[model samples]
Target: MAVRPDPIPAAQAAGTSLEEELAAVAASSLDQLRPRFRALFRVPVPDCLSRDMVARLIVHRLQEQRLGKLDRSLAEQVDRLGRGQESRRRFKAGTVLVREHDGVMHEVMVVPDGFLWNGGTFASLSIIAKRITGTSWNGPRFFGLRPVLKKHAPEAAVVVDDADA
Candidate 1:
């Protein structure tokens, strides 16, 4: 693998210190300056993203260096939020995830490495989801453990459950 040069080394640029440069970046219009970011980082800023995204990325890095890193729990929470909040309630060893299918409520117990369902340990909820539905599905969504983003509410999911009777 080729060693990549640092994008913006503080030592390379003499006039402005890292703080000063960061301040300028914070104040600059992210949408307007496609060339400036490219010149500084030697990589083009993607046009699809807003300027705030670029500025926030830089600011976050700078603050991270100044303030060290977030706590592990906090970091995990952030990661969870970024990944669509699947299994928000950090499941402990015996926590159970229940979902009703057809007319039966299938119970999945959270284990150390995976989940226990019907006396079997599975690696992922996706495997269980497929087993239950006999079709492909985003496991988190299938279990109603993931937040739905679109206009439709998660409650609107169509379940062909005959057990209501």
Candidate 2:
């Protein structure tokens, strides 16, 4: 088995001050970046970035190292919102969401405005879901879809307690 060397170079790891670290990252070359990326992320660095991107990445890593890594949920939400894309989701307009209630099959069409169920256009899936079930329900959850998890939604933001605020 091949043993990996200490991820950070000895010079950088030897208690170098933050100012020195920032300067080093600013001056870093591709050759210098591989081990630094490994040291920080504990993973091999991907080769796809341009030289300029690596420098920008180094600055970002340095900030994280000094302050703290972003919260995992927050980071994921930012990543989702940043791309401005739905990334080819499995369902879209004209797709059908179906549910069975009390031996009856209910089909809902994915419309641009909302779901179409029982020949009526409703504003939200939840409303259609309730109409089908005769009870309040989370529309997406009722249809066997992956519920929009609180962490997955930036709009379902994390709220601190009044005391925490």
Candidate 3:
């Protein structure tokens, strides 16, 4: 005669731990670099860099130079320490990128958060992948950015099937 526990709310259960981890990392990094950052730049410290920005930087760098073992090691460190959503989608406009730990969307825009573009253009999964591993992609583009994923065109020549039309 034991009662079953209620299921946790979707929002509560999703990515809360990740948000906390990111907050902790940001706080710790800021604490450690506050003095150096302050001395190095006149601008105020940023609250966070968007995952896209970080990815772009890393991917672009990797493409230009041979990272070898050192980059791989640093990437491993970041992969272990970093916390972020597994996916992202661009909308027509005004999409909320990061939601708060309490489940409210933060008011910050993605561009200021380090996303390279707006206009709600979808990003490629490969670009996102490179970012996570901290390796640069060797592409003609500056940041190793690619177009949004889409269905590949059929290789065979078109066959007319006009039943519906």
Pairwise TM-score winner, candidates 1 and 3: 1
At residue 55, give the lDDT of candidate 3: 33
Please list the residue runs of candidate 2 whose C-alpha ends up more than 4 Å from where it truly belongs after superposition.
1-76, 79-90, 147-165
What RMSD value applies to candidate 1?
11.9
lDDT of each: 0.68, 0.66, 0.35
Q: Please tell me which predicted candidate would have the highest TM-score against the true structure.
A: 1
For each candidate, what TM-score against the reference?
Answer: 0.43, 0.41, 0.15
Q: Write the per-residue lDDT of candidate 1 for residues 1-165, one digit (tens) a residue.
A: 975433443424667566876776666665434555565457888777687888776666656666688999889888988998653655567766777787778888778889888989998889998999898867777777676676753342233332223
Query: Considering lDDT, which of the candidate structures 2 and 3 is the better prediction for this target?
Result: 2
Ten residues in sequence with the least summed lDDT for candidate 1: 156-165
**Best candidate, lDDT:** 1
For model 3, how does the per-residue alpha-carbon lDDT over 136-157 read when each residue is reduced to its tens digit? 5322122222342436421221
lDDT by residue for model 2 (1-165), tens: 975543334334667877777777667677677778766667876778776777677678788877888898778767887887343233456776666676777777767787678998998878986787688977666665534656543122121122211
What ranking of all candidate models by TM-score puts the best one first?
1, 2, 3
